[model samples]
Target: MKIAIIGTRGIPNHYGGFEQITEQLATGLVERGHSVTVYNSHNHPNVAKSWKGVSIQHCYDPEHMLGTAGQFVYDLNCIRHARKNNFDVWLFMGYTSSSVWHSFFPKNSIIVSNMDGMEWKRTKYAKTVQRFLKYAEKLAVKHSHFHIADSPAIKDYLDKKYSVNAKFIPYGAVLPAASEEETLRQYNLAKDDYFLLIARMEPENNVEMILDGFSASNCKKNFLVIGKTENKFGKRLVGKYGSDNRIKFLGAIFDQETVHALRANAQLYFHGHSVGGTNPSLLEAMASGSLIAAHDNIFNKAVLGNDAFYFDCAACVKALLEKTVCTETKKTFTRNNTEKIRQQYSWDKIIDAYENYFFECCQSAKNESYVSSKRWACK
Candidate 1:
C-alpha cells in the first residue's frame, strides 16, 4: 500500500508524541514492505532522511507564524503531494491539520486521522483559539473516513461530544537501552542519585505543581527536568524554580541518548500531565523502567496499572517522600509495568493496528465508490 502521512514536524523523535508516532508508524509500515512516505515540515532541522524504513518528503511551510494558517499551508501542500503522487491512502495526526485536509481533499481518498486528545481543553489556548479548535475538531470527525483516539479517554470524549465512534489505538513506546557512563557525566547526574521529569513545560503539564510538590518533599533526591524553554510559561517556570541546585532545568534536550540515559538511570519518573490521554512521557518512563510518580487520572492508572504510585496534591507527595523506601518496590512495580507495555504498547503492535485501520478505511472508500458507480450506471 502506498501511504502518505502528514501533520508532523519531522522524523527522528526530537519533537513530541505526534512526531514520534509518525516516525514509528511510517517506519514500521515500511518494514512490513508497504510503501510509506512522510510529509514533514521543513521548518524544523533535518534529523534524518530516512528513519527505520520510511522515506521522508520534506515540504515548505511559510505561514508558520500565523498558527492555524500555517497548518492550512502545510495541509494543502501535503494534499497536493498526495494527489500528484497518486498515494493510495492519506493518514494524518492532529485535529487542526486533519480538519483542514478532510474539508478540502478529494472525497475518494482514504483518510484516517488520529485526534489524540481534547486539545482545545488545554489551558494554553486563549478563548478565540479554543473556539476555533472546538469547531476544527468537529470538522475532523465529520469528514474523515476513520478517526483514531490514542486512548479510551479520548475516544469517550469524541463519542460523547461529536457522536463519533473512533478506533482506540494507544501510543507506542520503545525501550531505550542504557547510555554510556560518559553520557551521565556529561549531564552531571550520577546514576540513581536524581529523579527525572521529561515533558513540555506547558500549563497542562502542571510543571509548577510538580515543582512545588517535589520542593515540599524532604527527600534528598535531586531532580532533572528536561524540555524546551521557548515559551513564556517555560521561562517563568525557569525563573521561579531554577535557582535551586536540587532542581536542575536543562533547556531543550535534543539528544535522544542523553534523554534515555536520564530516564533509564533515574530513581523515579515524574509525570505531571493534568490533561490529555496516555502521554508519551509516561509511556517512555515505563519503557525506561523508571518508577512512576504520576498525576491521579484514570488514563495514567489505566496505562501504569494499580501498582504505580499516584498523587493529587503536595501532601501526597510529601507523604511519599517521608517514606523514601520506594527503591525496591518501585523498581519491581516499574518492571512489571514495563513487561505490560512491552506486550501491549510496542511500536510493532501499535503500528500494525494503524496499518489495519488504514486498510479498513481504504475498503470503506472502495465500497462507497462502487455504490456511487452502480447508481450512476442505473441512471
Candidate 2:
C-alpha cells in the first residue's frame, strides 16, 4: 500500500515522541514492502531525501520564528503538498493543527487519524485555545474515515463521545542492552544513588510538583531533572529549587545511550505526565528496567497496572521517597515493567499491529465503496 504519514516535524527523530514513532513506523513499513512517505519540516536536521528505506518529503516550517501559530502554516504546507500525491492511505499522526484542513484531504484516500491525548484538558493552553483544540478534535473525528487511539482509555472515550470504534494501538519501545558502569562516572553519580525525571518542563507533566515533593522530603539523594530549562515553567522551577544542591537541573539530553543508562541506574524514575496515551518516555523507562513512581492517573495506571508505585500529590511523592521498600519488592517492580515492555510494547509487535490495521482499513474502505456502488445500481 502507498502510505503517507503527516503531522510530525521530521523522520530522523531529532525531536520528540511523534517524530520518533514516525521514524520507526515509516522505516518498518517500508521494510515490509509498502511504499511510505513521511512529511518532514524543512528545518529538520536530516536533509536527506530518504532515511533507511522510507521516503522523506520536506515542507517549510516556521515554528521557530512564529512560535505556536507557525505550526498551522507548517501543517497547511504539508497538506498542500500531500494533496498532489495519489496515496492509498494518509495517516495523520495527530489532530492538533492538520485537522482544521480536513476538507483538503484527498477524496479517494482513506483518512486515518491517531487522536492523541485529550488536548483540551492540558493545563498549558489558555481556555480559548483549549476550546479551539476541542473543536479541532471534533472536526478530526467527523471528517476522518477511521480513528486510532493509542490507549484503551482514549478508545473508550472516542467510542462514547463520537460513536466511533477507534482502534487501540499504543506506542512502542525497545529494551536497551546492558550499559557500562563507566557511563555513570561522567554524571559523577553511582548506581541507584540518584532519582530521575525526564519530560518537557510543562505543567501537565507535573515537574514542579515532583521537585516540590522531593525538596520537602528528607532523602538526601540527588534528584535529576532531565529536560530543557529554557521554558518559562522550567526557569521558574530552576529558580524555586535551584538553591537545593541536591536538585540538579540537567538540560535536555537526547542521546539514547545516556538516557537509557540514567534510567537503568536511577534509584527511582518519576513519570509525572498526566495527559497523553502511552507516553514514549514511560515506555523507555520501563524498557530500561527502571522502577517507576508515576502520577496517579488513568493513563499511567492503564500502562503500569499493579507493577509500579503511584502518587497523587506532593505529599504522596514525599512519602514514597521517604518510605523504604525491600530489595525483593524493587526487583519485582522492575522485572514486571520490563516484562510488560517485552511482551506488549516491543517495537516489532507495534509495527505488526500497525501493518495489520492499515490493511484492515483499506479492505474495509473497499467493501464500503462496493456496497455504495451496488445501492446506486439498484436505485
Candidate 3:
C-alpha cells in the first residue's frame, strides 16, 4: 500500500512524541514492503530526501517566524502536495492544524486519523482557542473515514461523543538494553540519589505542583527537572524554585540514551501529564524500569493500572515523597511496568497493529467501491 503520513514536524525525530512515533511507524511500514512517505517541515534538522528506507517530503513551515499560525500554512502546504500523490492511505497524526483543511483531502484516498489528546481541555489555550480546537475535533471526526485513539479512554470518549468506532492503538517504546551509568556522570548524579521530572513545564503537566510538593517535602534528595524553560510557565517555575540548591532545572535533553539512563537510575520518576493520552515519556519511563508517581487521572491509570503510585494534588505528591516503601515493593512495581512494556507496548507489536489495520482499511475501501459500482450498473 502507498501510505502518506502527515501532521508532524518530520521523520528523523528531532522534536517530540509525534515525530518519534512517525519515524518509527514510517520506517517500520517501509521495511514491511509498503511505500511510505512522511511529510517534514522545511525547517526540520534532517534535510535528507530519505531516512532508513522511508521517503521524506519537505514542505514550507514558518512557525519560527509567524508562531502558531504558521502551522496552518505548513499543513496546507503538505495537504496540497499530498493531493497530487494519489496515495492509498493518508494517515494524519493529529487533527489540530490539519483538520480544518479536510475538504482538500484526496477524494479517493482512505483518510485515517490518530486523534491526539483532548486539546480543548488543555489550560495552555485561551477560551476562544479551546472552542476552536473543539470545533476542529468535530470537523476531523465528521470528515475522516477512520479514526485511531491512542488511549482506551479516548476511544471511549470518541465512541460516545461522535458515534464512531475509534481504534485503540497506543504509542510504543523500545526497551533499553541496559542502564548507561556513564550518562549520569555529566549531570553529577549517582544512581537513585535524585527524583526526576520530565515534561513540557505546562500547567496541565503539573510541573509546578510537583515542584511545590517536592519543595514542601522533607526528603533530602535532589530534584531534577528536564524540559525547556524558555516558556512563560517554565520561567515562572525557575523563578519560584531556582534559589533552592537541591532543585535543578536542566533544560530539554533529547538524547534518548541519556534520558533512559536518567529514568532508570532515578529514585522516583514523576509523570504529571493530566491532559494527554498514552504519553511517550510515561512509556519510556516504564520501559526503563522507573518507579512512577503519575498524576491521578484516567489516562495515566489506564496505562499504569496498579503498578505505580498515584498523586492528585500537591499534598498527595508531598506525602508520596516522604513515605517509605520497602525495596521489595519498589522492585515489584518497576518489574510490573517493564513487563507491561515488553508484552503490550513494544515497538514491534505496535508496528504490526498498524500494518494490519492499514490492510483492513484498504480492503474495506475496495469493497465499498465495488458495491457502489455494482449499484450504478443495476441502475
> Could you give the candidate ranking by lDDT, starting with the highest?
3, 2, 1
The ten-residue window of minimal lDDT in model 2 covers 370-379
Writing each residue's lDDT as its tens digit, candidate 2 over 259-361 gives 9999999999999999989899999999999999999999999999998999989999999999887899999988998899899998888999988998887
Q: What is each predicted model's overall lDDT from 0 to 1?
A: 0.77, 0.90, 0.91
> Candidate 2 clashing pairs?
none
The candidate maximizing lDDT is: 3
Instruction: Tell how far residue 249 is off in model 1, in angstroms.
Output: 0.6
Expressed as tens digits, the lDDT of each residue in 266-344 for candidate 1 is 8777788877787887887788787788888878887877767888887776676565664578768878978977999
lDDT of 1 at 13: 62
List candidate 3 stretches off by more than 4 Å.
370-379
RMSD of each: 3.5, 3.2, 3.0
Superior by lDDT: candidate 1 or candidate 3: 3
